[model samples]
Target: MATNRLLRTAGTVLTATALLLSGCSSGDSSPGAAASGQPTNGRTGSADTMPEAATATIKPLPTAVPAALRPYYGQKLTWRECGIVGFECTTMKAPLDYAKPSTATDLKLAVSRKKATGPGSRIGSLMVNPGGPGGSAIDYLQQYAPQPDAVRARYDMVAMDPRGVARSEPVTCLSSAQMDGYTRVDQTPDSDAEVDRLTSALRDFTRGCRARTGARLGHVSTAESARDMDVLRAVLGDDKLTYVGASYGTFLGATYAGLFPSRVGRLVLDGATDPSLPARTMNRDQTAGFNTAFTAFAKDCAKQRDCPLGTGSPEEAGRRLTALFKQLDARPAPTGSDRTLTESLATSGVTAAMYDEGAWPVLREYLAKAQKGDGSGLLALSDSYYERDPDGTYANQMFANPAVNCLDLPGAFSGPDEVRAALPAFRKASPVFGESFAWAALNCAYWPVKPTGEPHRITAEGAAPILVVGTTRDPATPYPWARALASQLSSATLLTYEGDGHTAYGRGSDCIDTTINTYLLEGTPPPPDKHCT
Candidate 1:
């Protein structure tokens, strides 16, 4: 799933941590926080239009531990209480440039562990990541670890803020104040002037990141993060990494497996992403996925007494929402605070709900309020998606998200000219989100770091079985991606949850929970192509 668009689900363990949580928030009012979950969406054209992303001519990069890097692998963690009740925290270091071992640049990684409280035999540490390319794994484990009792009883739950993420030396682009205006800036510009303004804002954002953390920004690529994970794995005393990565985390996990196939142990990638898909395809599929999810929400809302977007059909609901957006575009609604609910914020708020059906009720309430000229509900939703605290502070989720995504892959669109060219296909893919998402996809084009990664298949041939889970109507991580990833990995078992929302792990599915726990604890992959309702 495109988690950088962000919030999984809150107040619900099952979907909350397993999906997108846009900009990371330290608190709950916190409903969804810092809301551009993913600047993804496109036209509803044939899949064939989504050309395969180009791969580098070079073979897959090797991640073998070099003699010079041995010090990092053998480093010891002197963990001490870092105030997360029952969890011990510490920091570890890795050379910032794995490619240049002798380079002085280095990175400090924030790591946390909740040691197993067991009656069962201990398996190794189950390293966890909540996605985002930027989602704080430490925050994820602390706030959203909904592991089975059996799994938690035996394995130490672990996570680290990948370099340039929370608690680490983050790649900062904007201050909270600057970010405040950035999130509200119109994404779907109607005039040439507006497009220039949006482009200028993005350019400023790119500059701020470079000004603040230029040296480190280029180093936080997923490959580098994967290498960093190896360092974490070694330091944690694990012979192999046993991980549960959701959404974007799947990319990181897959990268690790590709880099260190023999070191993969008990990996579960929920809401899988297809590494082979080009940025354009991923954006379009995700855009369509959100549209699909919105349709589902509309159908369910039509049965409610006060459906904000008419009760006729899902199509009508989309029409109503589109009209409301146009209305907001002309006259932003009052949010009860100084801030008004602009189209960008409102759109992001709606997408925040698309992550998990658990947020549907919240979306309905927000829409009703927005329609009533009280934009507070929608504003709160957007704030949650963006992780904008009432105190005006934001977590670094947004900053790190672009940092990693930009470095991991090339820009989705070359420039506004290209974006204009792709709009028709994007609109066909998702009339509701296409225009705005097409523009959002351009956010990476202004990045300071040139992408070092490429779209390539990962066979992880010698790795142990990898479990890939996908929900039928998951808005963020579409079902096809799970199928694609499962196929990509040499040894992978695909698990299907005939469901809605982002992920299926603990969303009250005993079958899913049991199957996953069995695999994790018993080291037995589920029978091939398992389905759970």
Candidate 2:
């Protein structure tokens, strides 16, 4: 995937959550001004900036479980064949409120596992997550989890759908028809009246979520999910949690290490996010990252024979693409079906292309068709990003995304005015991408639940060395965030991939894959500043 698209969506959606979930404290120092020459410090900052440093007191985990109260701790889990050949499916329960176990509601988590197939002893469960605060981890495991004999030999690959996510008490918001309308709502509102209309639509969207899924929405924070992960770890009989997380999953893994430091065994955090900065800074940094990715795309596109945006220069290609976006904003294209492709859909299509370079050729083809007024290709691309099925039903991402993000950090901009004020900077950072992204930041302004946590550092003071991976041109989780996170964690090792795209492992870099694999297998963390060309 192209790096720009990966980071742009992260900027847009993450910022939206930040705005909607305002008022939470961010465990970070004020960002340095451009003149300060002090890079935005997240990990290695002063005590004031590190909440983990100052708050040494651990509030006893909600409620204590005396031996009599702990029913499931050592209960033999009943597992059954779950249809797909070698896969086993099972449900695990967790308290809705950790502190009040008596008042706790049972949350059923869906889990799937493929047993180890090898000569080496099964070390433990290797849990995997595929980004979406809502993305289905089960689906990722089924479809994308590497099936190499080497990997399957020593690990029992496992995945779980977090609470309020797919297959595990999904948080339903809009129905198929309503979601269609919501997705079509003009994102780049031109006039003041249009902006008001857009905001009203956003409010309606959030209200729909509240009206439909109120009970489960508030409890889907990252902290709660991390807690759920611990329950999984205990149930799986793994002494330590071995996990591989991507995109937002990186944050999930980091949060896990923060909550249960001693339990961290082997962790691979790809496409890392700096959990130390507030949502606004993260959004800004992501916006800048997308711009960097876009520049790279433009350079490559300009040199291609089939380049639809012209071949004069990268700057010229960017201008052409920007003009196309503007044109789409003014008039959406028809998809032959009842569904029309709006500028928002068009933008999502472009953003989807940033995930992998393998998708670039596909993007070029779709852009060509889109320029000629045929939007089927672009629509398909957007559908994939939204995980929209042909039956018109949407995945839980639209629901779980807001639920998790809004709960993770405070909002970025308060209203359209704030977004407007930040527009010039966003546009300067990414001329082809600024406006739509600025508008996407508006989603959180309407979230139902207020944020519960702030941008805080996770330094399991006594934790083992954590490997933090970054792609130099990663659009979603910028390289700097990786650097900042590594610096912040007392025992973090920064592994750098001097290349493009989002996550590094399993994407073709022998250096990155081997280094991380060795760490996972041998508990040998890569040396700090380990650069892979």
Candidate 3:
């Protein structure tokens, strides 16, 4: 199978979820004025900005278990075949509130596993997540995860849908028709009236989420999900957890290590995120990352005869893309379907291509077609990015993406006023994406569930060695983030893939695959500062 999938904040629905964390968080609000995809001193921040980490130092988890939580700690799981031949599925319950476990509502989470195909003794359960804060870990495992035989032979590959994500109790907002209108709404507003319209739509979106999902929204923070990981680990009879996470999954894995450092076994965090940065900085850095990725794409495209952006320097290609966006903004292109190619959809399609270079040929094919006034190719790309079905129904990924992102960090900006002020920095970061991404950063501003999580450094102190992978020109999670995250963790080895794409693993570098596989199977980590071109 392919290494599989991921997205950033503000890019999901109308655009796509910036859950944009990997590419969406720092990858989400269109990265700000920073050196695009380059490393700064122990910080992957917007240009010269450094986001403030959470001030409240959470007390270390207690060694002794309390009575109310013991039921969760000791709960038994009933697993049954999920019809996937080898995989099994089950549901586990967690307290809605970790602080008040006995009084709060119980949460049911979905879990799936393909037990070790062992010729070797089984090590334990190896959990995986494909990032997106909203990406379906279970779905990723079923579809894309490259369960290298060596690792699969020694571990039960498992995946869980964190609370408020797919299969678990999901949070929802807009209906299909409502989402259609929302997606077409202008993201790059030029007038006060247009800005007002955008703000109103945002309010309505958040309001819909609040009205439909209720109190449960507040509890879906990454911290809570990390705790859930501990619960899952204990229930799986593993004293220590073995995990492979990419992009935002890195953040989730790091969070788990921070909360339960003693319970970590072998962990791989690919396309890592720097949790210490504030949402705004994350938005900006991600914007820069995309800029870098686009530069790469443009350079490559300029070589192809069918390249729509043309054979000039990458600078020229960027200009052409900018013009196309502006044109689409004024007059959306026609798709074969009823939907016209709005600027938002077009941007989403472009960003989707940034995730993987393998998609570039396809992007070129569509861009060539799009330049001729035919948007079927671009529209199809956008539809794929949004995961829109032929019936127009969307998978819950986009909806759940914001539900988690809004809860994970404070809003990048409180309102349009804040966003307008921040736009210069965003634009300065990437003249192409800065404005819309800046506005997109305002995604969580009206979240009904006040932010419970905050920018915080995760040391995962006293934990086993964790391997963090980064692709230098990765559109979503930049190389600097891998460096930043590695520095944050006390015991982490940095693995660098000097290449392009959203993530590095299982995307077919024998070097990357071998390095990661050796670590997973033999408890070995690549040389502390490993680099794979």
Query: What tens-digit string does per-residue lDDT give for candidate 1 at 402-472?
Result: 77777666667667887788888889878888888778877777777776555666678788999999999
Cα shift from native, residue 402, model 3 (Å): 1.2
What tens digits encode model 2's per-residue C-alpha lDDT throughout 501-522? 7778877888988898898888
Deviation from native of the Cα of residue 360 in model 1, angstroms = 1.2
TM-score of each: 0.92, 0.88, 0.91
Ordering by lDDT:
1, 3, 2
Q: What local distance difference test score does each model get?
A: 0.76, 0.69, 0.75
Q: Indicate the worst ten consecutive residues by lDDT in candidate 2.
A: 14-23
Say which candidate scores most in lDDT. 1
Where is model 2 more than 4 Å wrong at Cα?
Answer: 1-69
Q: Give all candidate RMSDs, comma-separated.
A: 6.2, 6.7, 6.1
Q: Give model 3's clash tally.
A: 34
Model 3 residue 218 CA deviation in Å: 0.8
The top-ranked prediction according to TM-score is 1
